[model samples]
Target chain A: MSLETLSENRSFGGTQGVYRHKSQATGTDMTFGLFMPELAEHARVPVLWYLSGLTCTHENAMTKAAAQQLCADAGIAIVFPDTSPRGDDVADDEAYDLGKGAGFYVNATQDPWKPHFQMWHYIVHELPELLGDNFAVDRDRMGITGHSMGGHGALTIAMTHPERYKSVSAFAPIANPTESDWGRKQLGAYLGSDESAWRAHDSTVLMTEKGYPGEILIDQGSSDQFLDLLKPESLAHAMMARRQSGQFRMQPGYDHSYFFVQTFMNDHVMWHTERLI
Target chain B: MSLETLSENRSFGGTQGVYRHKSQATGTDMTFGLFMPELAEHARVPVLWYLSGLTCTHENAMTKAAAQQLCADAGIAIVFPDTSPRGDDVADDEAYDLGKGAGFYVNATQDPWKPHFQMWHYIVHELPELLGDNFAVDRDRMGITGHSMGGHGALTIAMTHPERYKSVSAFAPIANPTESDWGRKQLGAYLGSDESAWRAHDSTVLMTEKGYPGEILIDQGSSDQFLDLLKPESLAHAMMARRQSGQFRMQPGYDHSYFFVQTFMNDHVMWHTERLI
Candidate 1:
């Protein structure tokens, strides 16, 4: 669980750091970013986990999200993990959506992809333990949020482990991945074309089986080019049938870009802070 | 000048756009980023020019500085220019400090760099006029700021054309560039070894000769790795001797990174907003 500091800087009256560690889940060196507000300088604070989309590293959100000042003001810590296990030895595909940068945040069950594509385990189990041990983050009060593929990760992970995460939110999440083209291709490659097995990692399927007791928040851009791939409307219908409550805000004239996420980032931080603190 | 929209996205309840245009001053196509807050949707807003440091493109400040949210809140439009004229035809040196990304905001008199390294004319005259013609920016209400080399550009440009810029500020500026290695090399190469001509583009020299009537604002990181190269102390002395009133607050335990800039970006935005509005 020992972490190596890649870089650290004072940002937004707090510490913004990047660290690398050997991961038991992925069996590779993993990098992650952490932002601890000034309040953490005195005492432990609630943490909000942020997972980036496909082809994004920890630096994507760290550099572009523009959420640090809001997080600092809210006195919350944020942890951003690399989207996938990365190394020369790690198995990868030439496609941007399937390999290297795209871990899909699932424990792969297929060969050539099963060993190191264990972001699900790395993020859900190992990373938290490391953070709780090494950083001033309150383990009891944790929330999760992310964008696109990472949004799917946040939703599915939160629902599966209801006791671990107190609140959950997402931006432009692929709400019903099992039915979408992207999901079918990725799940087929990683989980071996077993639709039954994918139910365990699909937010809509999992929620329909056993509804989440608490409310969720999601923001989607109406003008997003990938709106069809991210079937939010279908998810909303499924959640309605399951009796789960949440807010799905569809912003107009926005795209699936960091700009769209940054526009409403402060609101998301505040929503989590109110619940976490 | 005609400009083409390279890309545009919604951010912080506004528009973030990148544009490319053929520049008469530099004789090359140049790109710049613009952030127009929601206020611009209703009426013209004050414009702020942000010049980036050495070895940077327009994207550096746009992606990393984390200032757009604050600028949107303050109802200011920010224009970020490329540090240098960049094209395959543009002359360049092998070194990072002397070539493409390091324009030093000067009009080169030397052979190879002379044709396309006309950043002095680009920033002081052509860019502003182009912005005024194409955007919803109030031409009379404009302020300028930058980091390091760009910071030097802000100070020198604003002082030289005080009537054009309503306010000026900088982050980790190379204040006494005439006395630093970076300045000597850049000025020697660009202006052809004429020490006397360098004074025209030196902030310390300009301010000493004719003090700025309005107050200036500067933020310096005490722990900056290039603190010796960016001699704020020398600028402070020159200002005091010339009876110029400005605040040079040396922040403790900060560095020469976007992290430090983002920490104090809100304050700088507010400073410019107050004077411009």
Candidate 2:
């Protein structure tokens, strides 16, 4: 796939670039934001892929979380992929929890949604191949992270492909789709109401089966309004029951907003950098 | 001078709050952002005021620049004031330059604008008093900084009121508003056609006459789109010519966006903190 460089700006001794490309996975034009540290120009660098939450583009975490300075210091490249297939030709939904912004990182198996809602392939396959070919990304040393819905994507995807991604982290992630109301409803629409098929895409279920080989990092806010829906405790319980050596920090007085993410971004970046390098 | 708390979020062990109040100076409601360090809960701490650029609100620098953790580490509180008066009743122009977002930080002396465009008084007098009374602010160790038009606000205000502000800094500030086209035109509208009236508000002219009492720090991106309009070299030259010691860094490959501002924000906050503390 040919990539189009939309914009690039120097940030914290790195290049923060916005790129667009034709995606065969989603069958639409997709855009992603990237922050390549100075190390990438000189030699290959480990990359941390950040998936955004609902109703967010590549700009939200790229700008709000401000991972460049830490990533730059650690000589790591950070990539931000879109939440779902976009553009007018793509499928639409009236509810904020079901449609364009809510990909749930799954390939749709139903009509009106099957053609474009293939974010699972887009993120897990197409984008990674594109990045590995174009950028100085060490495929062996890649890590995955996200916020909320994207956090669901990160955990499930990393759990499924532990051999590909070396590390995994999340901020206020949806621990289980099958247990979540909106998540269950959306997954049913995309996967044809097959509850058994949803098990492979659920973090709590997957973690209970075979825990991730490496330690996982999770930061959930104590004051998040969406705390009930997220159900991070269920995943933490599953993780602990499986004897998973993960770090689950419940930050007090924090919320679901980027402010909460920014407060602990340095810790996450450094954690990934430590394992990545 | 009663302030209504619009919103407050916990950030970096501090409180990031958005407040609104009926301004006696502007004759309309004004909003501002404040980040009070946790140390302020027990004792008064030094405060830094950040003025935003044109086409920006108090939220822009607060969210994008992200100066909280560093300020928190240094135990300094920070405040953000609005650029201009707002509401349906206030006078506005079709253009982005001379209207609501472009207050130019001046007490307008011209028609239509004279009634509500009293930003100079609001920022220099009303805000300081309100902050001092409400927050745990050390009035004697206050500092000021801003970007673009707001940078002009910081430079001119700090120079004129040296006794009130101890340290000053800017990021690509308009040096001599009287010489620049938009600066000259906007100043003419806000302060009548008399060019002599603008010298007091121009950083170059102010620095040339009596230089700031303390060291000033300016970080201008070498690749800034508004390089010509900002005229940072003129301000640097004037400061140097007056034997005014300051730190003027030309950051290469950076632009005028918040990306650039965010990159150097930690440095500016630290610089202000060193002087403030």
> In order, what lDDT does every prediction score?
0.87, 0.87
Candidate 1 Cα errors over 4 Å, as ranges: A1-277
Q: Calculate DockQ per candidate and list them.
A: 0.01, 0.01
Alpha carbon deviation, residue A250, candidate 2 (Å): 48
Candidate 2 lDDT tens digits, A130-239: 99999998888999999999888999999999998999999989887798884898888888877998888889899889878887888877678887788776776565
Please provide, for model 2 over B1-277, each residue's C-alpha lDDT reduced to its tens digit, 9 standing for 90 to 100. 7899999999999999999999999999999999999999999999999999898888999998979998899999999898999999899899898869999999999988999999999999999899999999998899999999989999999999999999899988887789897599889999999889999999999988987877777777767788778876577556533545554555656789999989989989988998989
Against the hidden true structure, what lDDT does model 2 obtain?
0.87
Native-referenced DockQ of model 1: 0.01
True contacts recovered per prediction: 0.00, 0.00
Candidate 2 clash pair list: none
